[model samples]
Target: MSDALGYASPQHYPAVVTDRWGRVETTLVNDGTAFGMILRGNRFEGKSVDGLALVGPPVGSNPPTLCDGDLCSCTIEWRMPIEVSLDGAGPSRVSLSAHLVLGDPTPNRGIDSVGVTLTLHLPTGVVATTTPQELIENALLDLQRLLPDGTRLLACISCAFSDYSPAGTAFIGSMACFRDRKDAYRAVSGKRDMYDIWSAMSGVVQETYHCPDFARRRPGSGYRG
Candidate 1:
């Protein structure tokens, strides 16, 4: 949020936001660059902010009104710094970008359906490792592969990263009951312990995750060593 970051003044600037699902939204940053950073950084604060993206609305305009179709059809772009530790080899820094679309294209009454496009950029020599190979091997029960690219993988519903990382993953889709922004707001501000929130998200892959795929070690899943 530094002016050095090439951001415009708050009163006249629109901030780009990315949600956990990788959905990008542009909204008028109320205060200024610093304030915008607060909003983006505190995404857990509510539905409006699960994360922030590189997309934004025009300057001086209110946040765009997204229609059901917009949320359903929007493909979000996300970038994050990740550490991928393969077996016990070591942890490598990787750039993770997940292209996530919100809702079910074909709603399945009780089951939420989501489409995901994943792009992973590993370090210079990391691609040669079998880590990527293992990641696709130990997938979830419902995971279905649609395409594969060296280190990049894609699935219709979601994929798993347990084989390589020895850690479980989460798949969050945008369903009506699950996608409620209001509900997300309640989560971040509720009386729930911060650790509990983190624990809940960090636990073994649960049914809540449904969007673009992400990987993390599940509690009590056992050590990679």
Candidate 2:
């Protein structure tokens, strides 16, 4: 059966956290958060986002080098607006998307990256399907299982030290993660540029890129994911 949309159903609000024994810590999803939030336009999103990236190990003149003086270690692209019938009766339609490009191709070509992969959530219900969150999450997790050991989805988006910029952000969203990858933020501030200056303390990592030092977002830190 399809789950009905209600005040508590959307995954936008801060999520519940449980103890090791699965005991509830807070009755409300908004507990421990600085402010309550609501998600907008999430239902229309594609169940999954497809992406591609190039990765290589460096064997250069110096040993301590990491993706320097060469093509970026990775690049990814996600195509979207791919939609399906929530009730399984209507024709599938592609969702609207934007133009995006990540990096310059390596000058040398015989070994350019070309592997392909798909990321989509599959319908989970036995007799009926809601959107496709179940389907898509399963597919993405399965892909992670097939990846080489040590490969991870670590990024600023999931890091505890990072947060959205109130002043503004990149089109997708502005986030800050210091290059050193700390266990916590060096400092929190209301000034527009304080985030940048604090980030400079360790160094600024290229936003959205695979970073050398990545830590998961702390639980109950006001982040949804």
Query: Per-residue lDDT tens digits of candidate 2, residues 60-88?
Result: 33221112232222222233323333332
* TM-score of each candidate structure, all chains considered together: 0.31, 0.28
Off by over 4 Å in 2: 1-152, 181-207, 220-225
lDDT of 1: 0.30
lDDT tens digits, residue span 1-225, model 1: 233221244332233344334433444332211112322222211112212232343222223223321232234444433344333344455554444444433444221333444444655432222112112122222122221232222221122322112233323311111111223322442234222333223222212222233333332321221
State the weakest 10-residue window (summed lDDT) of model 1.
173-182
* Candidate 1 backbone clash number: 13
* lDDT score, candidate 1, position 185: 21
Error of 2 at 92 (Å): 31
